[model samples]
Each structure stands twice: as structure tokens, then as C-alpha cells.
Target chain A: MSDLFPEEVRTERLRLECESVADADLGERYASMNETAIEDGELAYVPIEPFEHLQEARDFVAQREDRMESGDAGTYVVRPRDGEDGAGYPAGEAELFAVWDERTAFMTFGLRKRFWGRGYSGERAAALLRLAFERLGVELVSVTHLVGNENSRRAIGKYVDRFDGERVGRFRNQHVIDGEPRDVVRYEVSKADYEASGERPDCEFVEERADGGDGA
Target chain B: MHVGVANLDCLWENRRVHTGVSLYRPYWGRGYAGERARALLSVTFDRLDLDVASVAHFEGNENSKRQMEGWVEDFGGREDAYIRNAVPRDDGDAEPWNLRSYSITAADYRDAGGAPEVELDPENVPEPTSEPTDLDRANDGGDGA
Candidate 1:
């Protein structure tokens, strides 16, 4: 477990943990958000059938974990405090997940419907990015809004320094959203840009599981 | 919303003013592309404080071109330069393609950042710089011509 993570880092707004293969249940739950997210994102970018079931979610999370363990990707979980769902947390509704390569971060909190409309996304993201920049030493992080997800767009907009207008190119073969392909609207942020944004990089959050374990 | 450009690793070698962009066709009418471009322009000029912010596209892809055009007008970008046949469409045969460019100088965007700071209500953030009328515009260009 020690080797699995660099060290336990806590902020007033979130707890950053490293996820492990054992945390398949969290992955499963995250996968559950796919159908809803499809309506919010992928449905607008490209066509993709809503994902249903734990196996698929587990598999995807496994892949992401592999990336993290192998140093190809960096993953972090969002554990919001109880109540105060402003950060998109309805106290045990879902887990916030951020996956990324050196240049991009794909953020999706495995949250429930109850978490929406709260300021959870923005506040939590600020803490996460702070950790990403100070500890992870990442250069740029990117995300996408699957068209019509104005909520995602609005929420995500706060975390990144919007630049270059680019749409998601064909990501593999897509068909879940009615057989149409998609181009997820892409967004990104850089270390330099992050610092430059005049945002407070030192954010606050409580602590939680690092290997993708549910704090609950 | 603000997003970081790639760490000028090899991207920001010079003070070129252009952005690499792609947006969903479904969200095409939303003007987010322009909004984001303007915001980036703000970053380049006000935050990172670079002298010029840029954006690019192929010669014929009007869809992409149109977005860049709005960026030029909205983000304080200038329509002064071009890269000839830099991007070639892949056909049976390869060919040189034009990579059109647009940009906002640091001075241009900093001044732009000062007004009507755009805010995301719940977020309560930066006031967006809305286009000013003749008098406001005169004061905006106050420091120089």
C-alpha cells in the first residue's frame, strides 16, 4: 500500500488516494454514471450506447489503474465531506475520479444525481489540481464535455485555462448514442497556466482512501 | 472557463498567436468555442502574460476557419499573418496545405480583460470583457492608439 501511493495528502475540500485493482466496486459504481454522462457528454460528441453493468466499469477502471501503476497515467479519487454537497457531493452519492496522461486529465466523478448543481465540482477540482501540480508534477491536464453538457462545461470551466478550440476526434469506434460517432469538446490546463490563472493552488479537503477505496 | 495550453514544450517556441481546436459538431452553435478562445486569449495576455496569443486552421475547412474568425474579433486577435500550405489533406496523393493563423497581442488582451469580467454566478469569478461602445472603446485604447 505504501508503494502504491507517494504519500497521503489531505486538503480541506478533498482527499487524494491511489486506486488499486481491489477497488473494482468503485469502478463499477463509476461505470454506473456512464449512462447519465452519456446524456451529458458522449451523446453529444459521438454516438455510444449507454454502458450497463459492473464488469464493463470494472474493466475500464482496471485499464485506468494499469495506466496509473505503470506511470502512463495519473488517477485520483474525490472524497467529498458529508452534507455540504456544494462540491457536487451529496454525502455518499458517488466518487469523483480524474484520469489523465501527461498532457490531459479526463475528470468524471462517479457521483449520483443528488450531487449535481452543487459547487462540488469546482471546489474539489481546485484541490485536485493543486495536488496534481505540487505533488504529481503534471504539465497539462485536459477534459471534454460531450456537447449539451453545459453543466459539465460550466463546472469544468473553473478548473482549466481554456485555450485552443478543439473538438474530440473519433475516439475508437463509437455507437452507443444512436450509431453516430462523436467528437467530445476538449479542454486542457498546464502547470504554468495553472499558476498563472491567479487561482489558489493550495486547496483544503479531508482525507480518504488512496488505492481507490471508498472512504465510506 | 480557462484551460492551459500544452507547456510550450515545443509548442510555444516563438511568440506565434494561434490555438489548436476541435469541438463537437452537436455543440457547434453554442459559441463555447469562441468563449473559450476569448478566455485563452485572456490567459495568454493577462495571466501567462505572453505577448501574442494564436489560433490556426487549414485553408479550406470553413467550419474551423469560421471559429478562428470569431476568435480574432472577440479575443482581440489580429488578422495579419499566414503559413502557406502547411497542412495537407490526406488523399491518394499528399499536398501542402495552408495553415491560417490569428492572434491577440498581450497589450490587446490585457486591456480586454479589465472590463465586464465574465463570471460563472455560482463561481463568482472574473468579469468577462464585453465589447464597449465608442466612449468605452476610446478609454480602453487610452494608453495608446
Candidate 2:
């Protein structure tokens, strides 16, 4: 289980890279995010700091290393094929994170406003599901949607099966964005359901090799 | 048959009284159906520690009824509890229906042989945690969506 985290995942259409401090303008880019943009998006919550400054974002990524080591946290960058042009959104569609046992991952996608109507969200979600199951070996994965988020709910429903009955629950104010202290609906997918979905489990994966002379 | 997964999700395995049997047409007349059913009997009678296993067949499924009859000769005897429409085949598109049952015991399974062994990786089992944590993580096996 400790070996579950992978630094990068390259699917057919997009590349999912876990962000570190070295990555581009994460701080300033994330800082540039306005509260309105986040509220409109119905994200978990907008951070207190107005701008996502370099040090702030770097420290965030650095804190992730500590969290991950203790099996408490993880974050990844979604890089879509269409490069991030002028808009500040990260190129990829979304990211998955599991803090502790990593039983199941919770995912959130970030397709830019321009890419809204495209079908990339579901496609990328399926790819991420594969990573969680075959790669990370999770038994289940669940997603939460803010009440009234019909678009996100529909997108999520079209993806995973096992649609466990929804339980209204509360999440963090700043950590999750659906707004302050709001109740959300939960949906989940179990390994049994995912395997039963008739999707192919036989995709060939090219393991990202590490540098260095190796003669194992 | 594809054995629609939807049926399983409905908790088919937990049903107190349900029986389903299928055989490939290509493998007919080879007693494969009987063998298939005896396998389930072994699971119920042996591994499940059930005192008896109930099996059934209807008027149209003579092959299946015959299979159950054979098992009785080996270890037990049977009597009809009631004539019932276990599965109605009255519909034009449906198949035939007849019903019968049997009881197999753990003792019988032990006498015949044993159930197959299963192994699971102990490490993968997640430890449950209280529900108040904010990280979507508990002691371990956490989620944060």
C-alpha cells in the first residue's frame, strides 16, 4: 500500500503529473484564482490568501511530501493535450487524493471554462479510475457533489456504478469548495462494481522508468 | 449466459431460497450441469457449514431434476414439500419450470472431500476509522474527494 503513489500517469489523451515545487507557476497561478471563480465552480472552498503565491504553493507541495510520507495526503496536476493557453486553469482535467489508508480516492477535475462542453471529463475520469484500481489497487472510490450541482452529479453518475445510496455529509470549509458548511451527496464505486462494468482490464501500461544505470 | 451482474448486486447470494442453473448447449448430455450443481452443493454443505443444501428442478428441466436425483442415491433421500411455481415458464418467451429440493450436510462434504482453499493478502484489509476526520482519512485507508 505504501508503494501506491506514482509521480506521473500518461493516459492516451492526457498526462497526470503530481505537482512538486519545481513545477511551473503553481503558486502564482493558484494564487491568481479569485473567490468568485471558485464559488461559481462550486469547489470545496477558496483558500484565505487572495493570491496563490510561489512560496505558498511550494510550501503546499512540500507539505504534501510530508503528508504522503505519513500516508496522509497527495495531489496531482492534470495536463491536457491542449496546452493551458492564457487562462489560468491547470491544463489537465483534475486530480485524485487519498489521505490515509488510501482505500478509495476522491477526485476533482479542473477543465477550463473553454473546455466545458467537451467529453474529456468523463474520459479522463475513466483513466483515473484505472490508475486507482489497477495501479493504486484501491478497493473503492467515491466522489462528492455539492447539492444542486446537477452537471457534476450527472457527469459523475455517468461514470462509476455501485451508486451507493447517498449520505448527506459535511466537509471542510476551506479544504473543500462547495461553499461554507454545506451538506453534499456522496457516490462511490467498489472494486466489484468497477470490474463488473465490462470495461477492459487489460490495458498495457508503460512503467515510467527512473534514471540511473540499473542491472537488476 | 453472461450472468448479468445486476442480479448479484441485488444480494442474490444472500437469498434464503433461490436456485439458478445454466449449461452451455455445446456441453449438453455430458453431465456438466450435474457437476456444476454438485459444486454448489459442496460449497453450501461443506465450507458454509450448512446442515443441508436445497436444490430444485421443474417439469421442463428433466436434466436438472435427474441430476439432483442422482445425488440423493449417494448420500440422502428427498420428498416433495409442495408443488409450486418455483419459476413460471408460462410466458411465451420463457423456459419451462419444475421444482424440487435437497439437503446436503457438512458431514457429506467431508465424506466426499473438501472445499477449495482461499487466500487473501492481509495487508490490503483497511482498518476502520471514526467519521470525524477532515482529511478524508481515518487511521488509514482514507479518501479525500
User: Could you tell me the lDDT of residue A130 within candidate 2?
Assistant: 76
Please provide, for model 1 over A1-216, each residue's C-alpha lDDT reduced to its tens digit, 9 standing for 90 to 100: 223234233456554445555754554445445565444532343323455766665665576566556653345544554444434222221122333322233444433445556666666566656655665555545455555557777767655533321232211111223533322455556667777766764554333444444453
Docking class of 1: incorrect
Instruction: Estimate the TM-score of every prediction.
Output: 0.43, 0.45
Which 10 consecutive positions of candidate 2 chain B have the poorest summed lDDT?
A: B3-12
- For lDDT, the strongest prediction is 1
Write candidate 2's Cα lDDT for A60-104 as tens digits: 556554544554333455545444343324543365665223355
Question: Model 2: runs farther than 4 Å from truth?
Answer: A23-52, A64-74, A82-89, A99-102, A161-179, A201-216, B1-145
* Candidate 1 lDDT, B48-94, residue by residue in tens: 44455556677788887787786577546565444432343453134
RMSD of each: 19.0, 19.9
Indicate the residue-level lDDT of A1 in model 2: 14
DockQ of each: 0.02, 0.01
